[model samples]
Target: ELKAHSEFRFESNTSLQLVLKRGTAEIFGTELAIDIPYNFNGVKLAVYTYHGAALEITGETIVEYTSEETPMPIYYNLHLALEQRRMLKKSPRILLIGSGRNTASKILANYAVRMGRSPLYIDLDVTNGSTLFPGTMNAFVLDKVVNVEEGCPSSTPLSYFYGQTSISTNMRLYKKIIAKMATVLYKKLEQDEALMDAGMIIIAPKWSDSVGFEILQHIIEAYQVTVVAVLGNERLYSEIIKKNKNEGVEVLKVPKSGGVIDRDVIYRRQEMSRQINRYFYKVDNEFTPYSLILNYKDVSVKKISEEFVAPTSALPIGATRIVDDIRVVDVEPSSAMNHMILALSACEQTEDEEAIAISNVFGYMCVTEIDDAKQRMTLLVPCYGKLPKPYILVGNMKWIDHQ
Candidate 1:
C-alpha cells in the first residue's frame, strides 16, 4: 500500500562484478551492460528506477554519502487533497423525517447547524397530543412549521364490540382546525421571507395516513424547493417512493436494528442530540461526497427487505368488508383493534333507545359477534335501525376456535 523510492547500499567482501538489469537484470542507465565491477572496496554505485521503468546507474563513484532522503508517501497526500475537495462541496439544505423517537433527526439537525444552516423542524402530526412537536419547535423555533392534516376517517363501523365509538365528526372538526393552523403558520413564514430563505425541513411521522401523503404532495407541487434528503421509517419511505418514484427523491431510513425511531419521543430526542454532536464533532469535512455515494445504499437495501419479507408486503387485510344488514353511518378514525370490533358489531338489529345508549356509552358501534365452540357468527347491528338480515356472516371464527 505504501509506495516510495528507496536507496539500497551494500559493501561486498570482494570486488564483485554485478549486472543491475531491470527485473533481476543488470543495467547501466539506458544501456544493457554486462558485469560492472567495484574497483575500490568502499566505492558505491547509485542504482535508481527512473520514470521509464528502467534501471539506471550513475557513472560517478560515491565516496562518503552520509544521508539519503526519499520522497514522502504519495497516497497519504492524495487522500488529503481529496478530503479538501470534499469539504469545499458540502451543501446545507437537508430535509429529515423521523419517528420523533431516535437520534436520526438530531444528527441531521446538528449537521445542518454546524454547516451554517439553521435546521427547520416541521411536525407532521396535527392531532397527537405529545410534547415532541413542541419540543422540536422550541429547539428550532425560527424554522418553518408545516402541520400536516390527518386524512379522512376509515369507511367502517366496528367499535361497539370493542367498547368504543365513532370519531368521524370530531375528526372533521380537527381537520378544519389543522388547516386553519397551517394557514396561519404559512402566513407567518410569508411575512418573514428571511425564515423562508433558510428553506424548510419537514420532520414527518410514519406516513400511514392520507394526510401525510397529501401534505407531501402539496408541498412538492407548490414549492420551488429541492428536497436535499429524507430520513424516516421504511413504510413511510415506501409510500413516498410510490408517490414520487420519478422525482429522484433520496430517502434514508435508519436501520431497524441500529437505534432507529420507534414511536418513542424520549429516544428520538436523545438520538437527535447525539446526531448533532456527531455532525458537529465527529464527521470529517470530507464526508459530503462519500455520503452522496452511499446515499442510495440504504434505500436499496430496504427495498430488498420489503421484497423478501412477506409480513412487510402491502395487503388489503384491513379493507372494508360488506355488512349485509348493518348500515354504516359515517367513517371515523380509531385504533385498529377498536375498528375491528365496531365492524363486527354493526351486523345486528337493535332498538333505537338501546342503540343510542350504546352509542352514548361506547361512541359508535356498527357490528356484533357471537362466538360458538365450532363456529362464530357475526350480527350486523345498525345504529337506531333494523336490518333485513339480523345476522350476516362476515368471516370464519378464529379467536373463539383457538380458545
Candidate 2:
C-alpha cells in the first residue's frame, strides 16, 4: 500500500479511494489520517509517503504517472511564517487578492487550519458562493481542520447579506458594506483573543482586470492589511506593490493551481441557488423552510439605488446622497424582484442610506410567490413563521428553483 517517497496521483476520469493503512503520508501538505478513506475525483492532488507505509486503494480509477510540480509547498511555507508570527504574538492580517476562480484562498485557509491557527476566514466573493453562500459576506474562525469534501458548515460561519453577486453592479454600496464588515470583524477580534492574535484571512472579491487594481487598493486600506497575497497575476503584483505606500505591508505573489478551471455564469448561478437552498434545507431534504405571507406595506422593499433625486439634477448647498455619481441598478421589489432573494435588515425603515448599507441581516428569504393583486408576497424563510425584522432589502438577484 505504501512505499518510501512514493507518490499516487489520480486522473480526471477516475475516483480515488485511499485509506492510510501504515506509517505516514501527506496530501497537499496535510497529513492523511490513519484508516481514513478519502475519496477524490477530477482534482489535481497527490498522496506522498516518506520512509514507506500504506494499506488500501480500492477504486475504479486511473493513476496518472506524470511528474508535475506544484507550488503547494511554497504556500505551506507562507502558512508557517504566519503561524510563527502568531506564536510570537504579532498579529498579522492577510488578504488574498486575485481576479478569478484560480485564486487558491480556500486551499490556503485550509492549510492555515492544518497548521493549527484559528484564523478568521472572511469570504468576499459573493458571486460563486464558495465559502458560505452566494450574495453573502461570511466570517468563520478556523479552530479545527476543515473538511475536503464539503464547504464550511452553515453553523460554523456568521454570514451577512450583501444581497447581490457582483461588486461592479453597486460599487458605492459594496465599498460601504466591506468597510462595515471590517469594522464588525475588528470588534469580533477584540472579544476573541485567539482569533484576534491569529488575525484575519480574507478571500478577496473576484475583481475585473480593469477596475480590480483600484478596488484592491481600497480593500488594503480598509482592512489595514499586513500582507497582500497576490495569486498568479504579475501585473497585479507589481501594481499592488507600487500602490501600497503603507509601511510593514508585504506584497507576495503566490502561484495559481493549474487544475483551477473557470466557471461560466450559468454554472455560478446554479451553484448560488444550491448554496441558498442548502442554508435553509440540508442536503438530506429533512428540513423545511417556513412559508410566510406578508403584506407589502409592512416591509420596506426599496432598492438601494432608488434615487429620490437624480444625480445630474441640482441639489441643495449641503445635501448629498450615497448614489451620487455611483452606478446602481435599482430593483423594483413589487415587479422585478419576483423569485429573487431578499435580505431581512436589522436597520429600521427610517434609517439613513449608510445605516441600511451596514446593517446586519437576520436571514434570507426567496420571494417565492408575489401577488400584486392582494399586495402580499410569500417568502421562503429559514425559520418557522418568525420574522426577526420588518425591513427587507431586495437586489437584482434571482433564483430559479429547478425543484
Candidate 3:
C-alpha cells in the first residue's frame, strides 16, 4: 500500500507483474489502467500516487520500498509548462541532462504521449538505450504510450551504430554521428507542422567533467535545443549556467527524485547484457529467431576501426589534421567473431563508404559460429525469412549470453 505523496520504488531482476487494486497511480507519467497486469523484467522503476493506492505485486524484486519524499510536484509542473508550449504550437526541444540513471526525460516523454502528442525521443546515452540496443543511438517517434507490459516499443527506429557501449571509446565518431543524425532528423521537423509542434525530448549523459560539458554544448547546437532541464546536480547546473554561454536556450534546475539510485559499473554491464538478450530473444521469449547459415561468397561483413584524433592545440599552428573516423573495412571471419553482434545495415551494398557509414539500421544479428574450414558462418537473427540486406556492419561490441 502506498499513501498520499509517497511512491513505491522497485528493482526486479526476474519477471514481475503489478496490478492496481484501488485508487489511482501512475508510472513514469503514464497513468496505470486499473485491473491491468503490467509486466516488468530486469528494470528499476517507481509507481507513484497523488492520493493513495493499493497494489497487487507478484514475482521477485531485488529492492522494494516506499519514499515519502519525491520531486513529483516540480516534474509535474514542468510537464504542465511544456504542455502549454505545445498548445501554442511553439516547438520545445527539451534536452534532459543529468545522472546516467535519471528518468526525468522519460517521465516527460510519457507525459507528452499521454497528452496525445508524438514527441521524438532522441537517446544519446549508449550505455542504456531507451528505444533500441545498448550500443545504439536512436530517435524514435513515440506515437502512443508505450505498452506497460512490453516496456520498449517493438517498432524499428532511425538508429546509428556507435559500435561502443561507452562514448569515451570513440568520442570523435560519437560526435560526428550525432551531427549526421541531426541533419537527417531535423529535416522531418521542418516538413511536418504537427511533428514540429510535438518537438523532441533529448536524453543525454551526465556532464561529469570538462570533456562531457563540451560534448553537451555540441549536442545543444546539433539538436537545436530550446530548453535544458538539469536534474538534481547543483554543481553541474551552475556550470551550465556560467559556462554553456548560450542565451537563446532556457535552462532550469529540476530536483532529482529520492528514488533515483546510482547504479555501479557492474550493474550497468549486467543491464547491457540483459538488453542484448532482450533484443534477440525478447523479454517473454514470445518470438523465436531463426538460425541462418551463409557461405563466405554470398555475404559481406565489415568492421569499423576506432581511431583517435589529437586535440587542436596539439597540432602545429597553421596546420590542420584530417582523420578518417567512419571508415568500415572488409574483414574475413575468424573464431574471434563468435558471439559478436553485427548491425544489419539498411544499405544493400557496402561498396560506397559514405552510404554504408550513414545507413540506418533495420535489424541486428549475432555471429554464433564461423566454420573457417568450410568458409561458412552461422548467424542468429531475430527476423523471419531472408534478411532484407546482405551487408552487415560489425563493431567492437560483443554479447555473451548468460542464459
Across 180-243, the per-residue lDDT of candidate 3 in tens digits comes to 8899888988898888899898988545574678789899999889899888789888988988
Worst 10 residues of 2 by lDDT: 323-332
Q: Model 3 TM-score?
A: 0.92
Judging by lDDT against the true structure, name the best candidate: 3
Pairs in steric clash, model 2:
none
Per-residue CA lDDT of candidate 2, range 1-403, in tens?
5557665655444555668888987664457788988775434455656666665766665445422455555666788888888888788888887643223555566677776677887787777657767778877787765555334433456666776777776666677777888888888888988887787788888868766777777778888889988887898789778878878889998876544446677656556766666667755455787789988777667456622335645666677644463322334347556788888877766546667666877777888888888988888887886676666777667875544
**Global lDDT of each candidate:** 0.30, 0.69, 0.81
Estimate the TM-score of every prediction: 0.30, 0.81, 0.92
TM-score ranking from best to worst? 3, 2, 1
* Winner by TM-score between candidate 3 and candidate 1: 3
